[model samples]
Target chain A: MSHLHSLKRHLVARYGAIIAITVLLLEGLCMFAIRSYYVNTIEQVLSNRVQLTADYYQKYVPGVTPLARAQKLLSSVDKDEVALVEVLDLQGQPVLDSDGFIADYRHTTPEVSAALNGQQHAWVGKSPLTGEKILAVAAPLCRDESRDTVGVLRYSVSLEQTFRVIQRLYIYCLLVGLIVIALVLALCYSLACRILLPIEDLTIAAKRLGAGAHDVRVRQRSQDELGQLAATFNYMSSQLDAAERAKNEFLSSISHELRTPLTSIKGWSETLFSGKLVDKPNQTQLGLEIICEETDRMIGLVEDLLDYSRLQVGHITLSLETVEINDLVTEVYQQLTIRLSERHIGLTLDLQQQLPLVEADDDRLKQVLLILLDNALKFTPPDGLISIRTRFEQDIVITVADTGPGIAPEDLPFIKNKFYKGNSKLPGSGLGLSIAQNIVQLHKGRLEIASPATGGTTVDICLPQSTPWTAGTYNWTSKANSTRQNLS
Target chain B: MAKVLVLDDEIRIRGFIVVNLESNGFEVVEAASGEEALRIAHTQPDIQIALLDIMLPGIDGIEVCRELRQSYPAMGIIMLTAKEQEQDKVSGLEAGADDYVVKPFSPNELIARVNALLRRVTLVEQVSSSSEELICDPFVLCVSEYKLYKGEKSIAMTPTELAVMEVLLKRSGKAVSRDELLDAVWGPDYFGDPKIVDVNIRRIRRKIEDDPSRPFYIETVWGHGYRWHGESLA
Candidate 1:
């Protein structure tokens, strides 16, 4: 039943109904007008015929009997036009009949009686002689020049033929109307199909797209609204496909990256556990060192991945405070000094005498500084120069510059994107730069990288200057310290 | 001592393998890239085996294995692959690697594989020196020359394949159990799966038989092992 209701809602039902109603109303009006004209013309022609018969009887057969005159008049008139003629006396008694017989003597029609009173009259009624419905007209007849009525002359014509023609015409109009409605319905069905087919195709394509069939597209050749809609859908699907590919690539790379450190740790632990190095103290010491270092690398990788996931979910909370920029830089540099020296890279710190304190997370700022320094160390060759400098401008700017092979121009833009590793052969997980950038942004600071054409890279971290401490802020910090102590 | 080439891009891993292999009384040569590995293989004829890492800086391990297999058919090749990459192990084997040791593997497992491969090489060499050649119908095994010939065509075989063929032919018309073949080819000290015997047998059949599926010389003995069907020549 619902299927039928929907079918009726289509163009066939909607447009066809309008066309059918209009045709029906026009057909009815045409039939009514034709019927009125037919009846009126027939009545007028019968009245005139009756008057001519009365005149002829007075002029040509003055001495004849009234019955003979009536008979003569009916015989002379056309049978198709005038079906009956009658002559009645002043008392409304029929004297003559055109059929040469009378069924009743006192059955004079009202028109015939009115004619006997010397008034011409016409009416639409049944003929008494023929018993058929007809239009009859009656007129009075006088003798010589006297106005006294001699008898009444009446004429009537059958209405059956006019009614039959009108009925046949009505049937033709009905048939024509039906054909036109059928044609309109067929056109409407095709028109509805033309509009609905593309929409159906788009629905199927959208389902496939949702199912991860990213290459699915609808064919749209026309420059209409649906075509434009299809074009937009295609563009969106392509974008999703690219994003999915990038995600898969990142997952594979990250897995490989995570596995490398694991391999080292496992290999070294197994080596040391095998009891082969027990007799040699120095080898044992070296083995233990490698095991510890590889373990640290693995832990760092895990922490980096965890931080990236937390940042993705917007779950990172910072303990913000006023941190001296010089202190933060010095702490990170001191931690990385031994590692840099191992690579034969020199670290030079150029700190301004009066560097302003910045409002930021001190731990998170140290993390960013360490990430930048570690990246520079990994890329720089032996005996390379790395400089850490702090200066005060609109913001407290801390720059770490190294004489290393700088990033390629094309890879510079996407370096900060999560899991975007420009070179797969590198040892670190690709989330380092993105994580550092996120932390800096959380502090409302900006981090920028510049790779000079000559050959070196520099990373600049700018933090907003801290507002002067007030008594209220001091109380807030004390309360925060108490909360931290309680949690620990 | 047998010379072995250890190829890995990581200095620490290379150092670990060198220390372990050297402690086991094998001379080790290290190469950081595939190109260096190929150069060393070309120059050092005495190097009997190579432990190649699958992930290298240039010309990855699979390609290196293919190249080295073409140049030195007698040399043993063991691929060092990451445990999670199953496809790498299969591809390495398909590229003519004799065996594979997954990364994060125990040093004992690595040493055992190296010893097993080297033992097979030593056994084949001893067999070749003892007898100049071993013959079966339509095939000739030149033991001392380390070559095999079927009619006029020369067949290439790894050291493990040669050792298995030597054992099977010496005990002709006798079914050799997989364990016995493993003992004769890999030595008594080797602790590994006996399936290694089946893998070598399959490789040997592909090189020697016209139809490896139905071998004329080597035949399976129901539940036992392989039998040398030399009765066809009689």
Candidate 2:
């Protein structure tokens, strides 16, 4: 609103000044033309009168006395015509006046003396008698036989009426110029407002949205480009609103997820340290068991977060190796034997002895295996059936299926998205599936999940047999070194 | 022994609470969800306290607190919540929870807060046998039945609110300091926040006083405590 209002100021300065100056110039030109036209008409009429009177005198009045000729010309002048008639002697003295008075010729104009010297001339100035603006023309009279000038014929007309008309034209031009300036100012102001008002609204809305007032939306006025911009602003604002909501929800869920175990561990440690359970040996043992299990849960959460961070920055790399799938499966099964027996879940593994060695990272493969088995154990109730198998048909395939409650159809599509823990209440950091997909993709493999109609889920990991290909290397954790030692 | 219901989705934390309470001379009952807790509360009418965790799978603890308060106004409720969920704490308190213990709290702080709330919200039949009933204008206190009546109609109040009203009525027309009220309602050795007294008094006034905003029966002495204007009749 101040002078910093650049749009309005720009419009008025760039075009408004131009229009104002053009109008002023046209008005000035019009006034000048009118004044000059009136004055020129007066001069032309006076010159024509003097020339005609001179010719008449050359034929008839040259030989008469100068006084008698001046009298005769004054008397012959028509009363209705505006031009005044005067006759002058050879000495530039007035011999006859149309107003019927003879007075000072000491202030004689050059045109009068030049006419007496046998020439013709005209002058425009104030009349010596009444001080009225006038145009005067003078010419010499001659006889055809002698060829010498005898007297001068002069005609003068007052220009007051012509100047009055020109002054009126100037006033009219001035009024028109003022009106034009006002119109131009109004036009510039409207044009600037039309372009800038919506933009200002968008700016304010965008600022509020940036400040985390995510539900803000700009007002849309027209179907023009600015209106489209406003629509986009509104759309973007809603998207930010949803994202902020999701982020907060995730924070709250993550906060609860992290705090529960911390509470258990902290509570157990405090209980154990108090030695109040010292006499109750079973309670003390139970406290120590909970502390260790909660510590392990914390470790898993940290590992998932760390892996996700590394994966996001494109830093995860696989140390490719020739590996036996059955051996890896057996090792993972051995790792989970205690957990499986605790839940009384039965496992059936069918390993293909002729399976080809696939190029993969052993440590990462172990992590994916652990994630699948852990998910199975968490979801499956006691005495449920769990099965694992490996087969080869152009690619090595491994499937881990659990007799557990299958995922909802709506939730299956987004199950692999990062931090997308859809209304499921299981107790993991929601990054395991996403990380598993990334790991499989790094190995040129595919991960597929399916929920059969018999109320269970099956996950398939298909690893393509690499043709001993090599291209690039990235820095990864040093667990590859330990795996290499074991394989050797 | 005091009987308490421990409701939590996490098995380990629930065990911790149960063990702590059991060793401190309390009988413990456990429920894994809001549905189970409500079921247990319906079956067992004598449970004196319920310790609820705010975050659970089926239904949140605040809803449970509301339902419990609606049905059993005298039951003492305590919320166990994470420290970062500050809004949950306020909502829990507004849902008629007597106190809250932030997660990762020391065993001593947890027990102390729990015991302080238990004292205010529990009826201990150890009053002197001298006065069987106390009477004031339009109000009657039945010490034998542990009830209050306004013009022959009983006013439903939580144990904590009734205890505060009883203290103010006992020392009618005398300014009782906040500390003095705290020691009377809670035990003398109870080291906890005194703000619980104000919350209880407000709840009590809402039930008895016509306008809780401008209280007349119980007057607050500026920079001190409350004074009851009634003359006690026993």
Number of the predicted model whose DockQ against the real structure is largest: 2
A1-488 per-residue lDDT for model 1 (tens digits): 34433754665777988988998898888788887888888877777787887887667663477667666656676666445777776666667677776535764788877897889998877767678777778899876677788888777668778889878888888899889888888888876665666677677888899887968888885668888888888888888887888788777776766666666667667777777777877877877777787778778988999998876665676777777789888988898889888879999999997887777777888989889988898888899999999998898899999999898999999899887878657778888999999888877789999998898999999877877763126322233444765698
Per residue, candidate 2 scores C-alpha lDDT tens digits across A1-488 of 35337767888788889999999999888888888888887788788878887777777563367777777767767777777777877776778778887756743877887887778988888977779987889898777678798777788887788778778888888998999999999998888888889888887787787786977988898899999999988898888888788678767667777888999988888877877798999989999999999989888888888998777665676776777889999888887887788879987787989788877798899888888877778788899988888999878998999999977788899888777777877788888888988888777789999986678889999998756444223323345444654588
Against the true structure, what is each candidate's TM-score?
A: 0.72, 0.78
Shift of residue A97 alpha carbon in model 2, Å: 4.5
lDDT of each candidate versus the true structure: 0.80, 0.80
DockQ, all candidates in order: 0.46, 0.60
Question: Once model 1 is optimally superposed onto the true structure by TM-score, how far is the C-alpha of residue B204 displaced, in angstroms?
Answer: 6.8
Per-model fnat list: 0.46, 0.68
Residue B211 alpha-carbon offset, candidate 1, angstroms:
10
Q: Candidate 1: list runs displaced more than 4 Å.
A: A1-251, A324-327, A348-357, A389-397, A450-455, A462-488, B130-151, B160-234
Model 2, B75-128: lDDT tens digits are 888888775455776678777777778786677777877787787654534442
DockQ of 1: 0.46
The most accurate candidate by lDDT is: 2
